[model samples]
Target: MKGRTIVLDHIDDREAAALMVDGKLEDFLIVGDAPAPGTIYRARADRPVKGQGGMFLTTPDGPAFLRQVKGLSPGALMLVQVSGYAEPGKALPVTDRVLFKSRFAIVTPDAPGLNISRSIRDEDERDRLLEIAHECMDGSSYGLILRSSCAGEDAGEIAEDINAMLAHADQVINDPETEPELLLEGDGPHVLAWRDWTDPAEVVTQAGGFDTHGVLDALDVARGVSEPLPGGGHLYIQPTRALIAVDVNTGADTSLAAGTKANFACAKALARALRVRGLGGQITVDLAPMPKKDRRGFESALRAALKADPIETTMAGWTPLGHFELQRKRARIPLSEVLK
Candidate 1:
């Protein structure tokens, strides 16, 4: 039950809802209109476009890009999963690998395997979960991914959930009557926030009288503005066309210990901000100058902070100018466009 609260509020005169976690605006989700991520659509592959390396597919949500169309040919029909929302002037990214996710696990029909969350750092727990996954899979040909939320759940409950999801996926995939339509809508911003939280009951939904302050605050941060960090420092977050750039600054009068603490604080805050704002792609963090000997400690602290992120992030080490370089997968539309 120890987790952030999710707030879903209907926007006035807009076709979307404002999603916030612990009173911080996360992103906007289309209400009953746009196709959500994870929606399964039976699509017909269109002619392949040169240089894109992927085939265009006619889906229920219109034309979508099949990022990896390995044995697919033009006019062939197959099931495709919506990977992300359709942004303006761009088609939705669909994948052959369809995954059904619940609170604790994911059921992937095309890919049959067992994978544990990287956030599950405990070796013993990981081994136990792997064993449980094997037992739950029980010779089934469905991929089961144990999420971080499965940490403290009962083995029986997890097994039941996975079994049920696999059964549902199998029924949908094998049913001949299922046409080229949306099987299920993907999670909206509010649901995404709920999934990341340790407890779903913490979420609060408001049908009216939505607060706009959090939205404004999130917009400011998304526009690359500086915000105060802990221990008397500030962090400047700027999103450029290429990548996100963050600068950590300590005031001239602050002591070295305070500055170092602020830098660490900035790292943790930056991670949360990225998730909250839905900022993805490459990111660089420029910390206040530290002693050469202290780089290792800083990197370790930053890495630990970034590990909490649900999105796939890779630490690419420090740049030549002593800035930290990291890459994150673009799971959704950027916050800037969502607000617009």
Candidate 2:
């Protein structure tokens, strides 16, 4: 798994920026000339709004809310991780549980434990990684999660990364600064995409400007237009306030074989579209009619395609009307909202 190229550019839209991976648009970020997600700040808890169930925290960036304030008190100083940018008239979402992500591991400062990605389903491999995690993280008051990229990695390399992250976490924690300010800045989406998705060795190239031809082309594709698939079929994706709806049109066809192939192609395209666009919540895909015998196979293909997505997703079986239902975890604001 070689790392893909990462292209960063400022989009013409003042409200948005673009992160392209492997020459394709991967994310639309609402930078708004402010710090992006993953930034770390040392904040002081302000007065708690009793009815809101959360306390306002004053940070260098601005005021933010700690949704779950179990052990926090007013004026308490603590490290907070910025989860996302602040919405209009809303405070930024901050968390005390911080995670430092590397290519093959995640370091948790607040939670001290060892875990593995559920995607690594092999019993023997899981046990082996657990042993490695314990060995590398022993005596450290931090948590380590072995990412899927650690599947075939050398144990020594994994240990090295764990040690480095642990050391970095220690540096941040040991600092005695009492001011509410930024302690660390998170990597932008382009860097994060490479760390999470691409191989470590992949070369990343950035475009000089947002108006470059490559970026414009990628943005055009990401604008959520109908995508043509192989064999003269297409996928029509529509995202509304409620949920996303996809229509799989096989076009005017004479043979069942062509239609089935088109369905398969459409399924792949739909999965990619949903992931790239970061469209979450409920989703329904209307597929072309097929025989009862072929339905199982088509469903299996669709499920398999979606499994590759980084976010948590589940297929909710078919509706009575024959549309396939899916639910994905909403990690952030949707592309539609960000673009606006």
Candidate 3:
């Protein structure tokens, strides 16, 4: 219960991982039946959706939809990667731009360049990483990116990671097979927990770590419609057919700034709730009845809170009925569906 901790375990026969910060569940990931994002496939184009500038394809997993495709005729074979999860009754989202991602390096087939993460501000570290990239990539045409996690890591390890990713990219890109197939399966929850949770934490890899560390209790709270926010306020997260509806309640905090406190609390907790539950797409928040002048402050607070989130989100601004909106990417299957 002190510092950061990670618990890797299986829940109901599904691979699951949890990131706990000071004993609270900060993030969660679990395997679902659908193919995870980053899965590579040798797929064939099927049909174009008129007026949408998109095309449908048949992948090894199932049907996939690619956007902004051109010069591709029906039955054309090309490599595609899963960009994100699909909505209910929708085609799996995919893209032609394939990327091989690891903890320390990323191989980009579409973009050709060698770059280091801007977060590595130390010139010496940047130069060292660039040397490793150059040595690993050699004269390859594919682009290589040294991720921020490489900072302070062993040079030999970094070089090894680069070489591994390069090897994977080559194998997937030059399969020489003309038939549709699953070239590479996506990284699972346990692997992703090691890759993305870079912060220093105590690792728990044995089974039942979830129960031992209270992750199961946290998940049970996450499954509920109402979420506890700071400052005695709370919010209900309900996923409907069209969008996620969140209603804020002050919960007996009768103070002069009660509305402002409740709204800000909701703003901070909303993103985390959505992330923990793997809910995405349109999100509409009905804040407490605060003065309209506080709208800008609320927006700034929400943006700041969302900055730490890895998923792509767009603040769609306030609506006519005083509700705030956000367009979030569907990067993971909904937890309710996955758990059920």
Clashes of each: 1, 1, 0
**How well is each residue in 1-340 modelled by candidate 3, as lDDT tens digits?**
8789989999889999999998889999999999999999999999999999999999878899999998999999999999888887899999999999999999998999999999899998888888888888888999988888999999988888888898999999989989999999999999999888887889999988999999999999899898988887889899999999999999989887899999988878778889999999999998888998898899889999899888889999989999999999988778899786
Backbone clashes (count) for model 2: 1
Winner on lDDT between 1 and 2 is 2
Error of 3 at 198 (Å): 0.7
Lowest lDDT 10-residue stretch of candidate 3: 331-340
For candidate 3, give the lDDT of residue 77: 97
lDDT by residue (tens digit), candidate 1, 1-340: 2334455665444444444555665444433445767788888888787787899888777888887557778888888888765546678788888888877889987777899999889999999999989987887888889998888779988888788788778876886853466666677656655555555534456554244335545556655567767667888878887788888888653676765676778777777667656667789988887777877787788788877666678989888888889988766556566455
Runs with alpha carbons beyond 4 Å of true place in candidate 1: 1-4, 13-34, 49-52, 85-88, 113-140, 146-160, 175-180, 206-224, 252-262
In TM-score terms, which candidate is top?
Answer: 3
TM-score for each model: 0.75, 0.69, 0.98
Clash number for model 3?
0
Clashing pairs in 3: none
lDDT of 2: 0.73
> Per-residue lDDT tens digits of candidate 2, residues 43-90?
999988787788999999788888857767888998888875554567
In Å, residue 145's CA in model 1 sits off its true spot by: 3.8
Q: What lDDT score goes with residue 141 in model 2?
A: 82
Pairs of residues at least 3 apart in sequence or in different chains that clash in candidate 2: 3-199
**Which residue ranges in model 3 land beyond 4 Å of their true spot?**
none
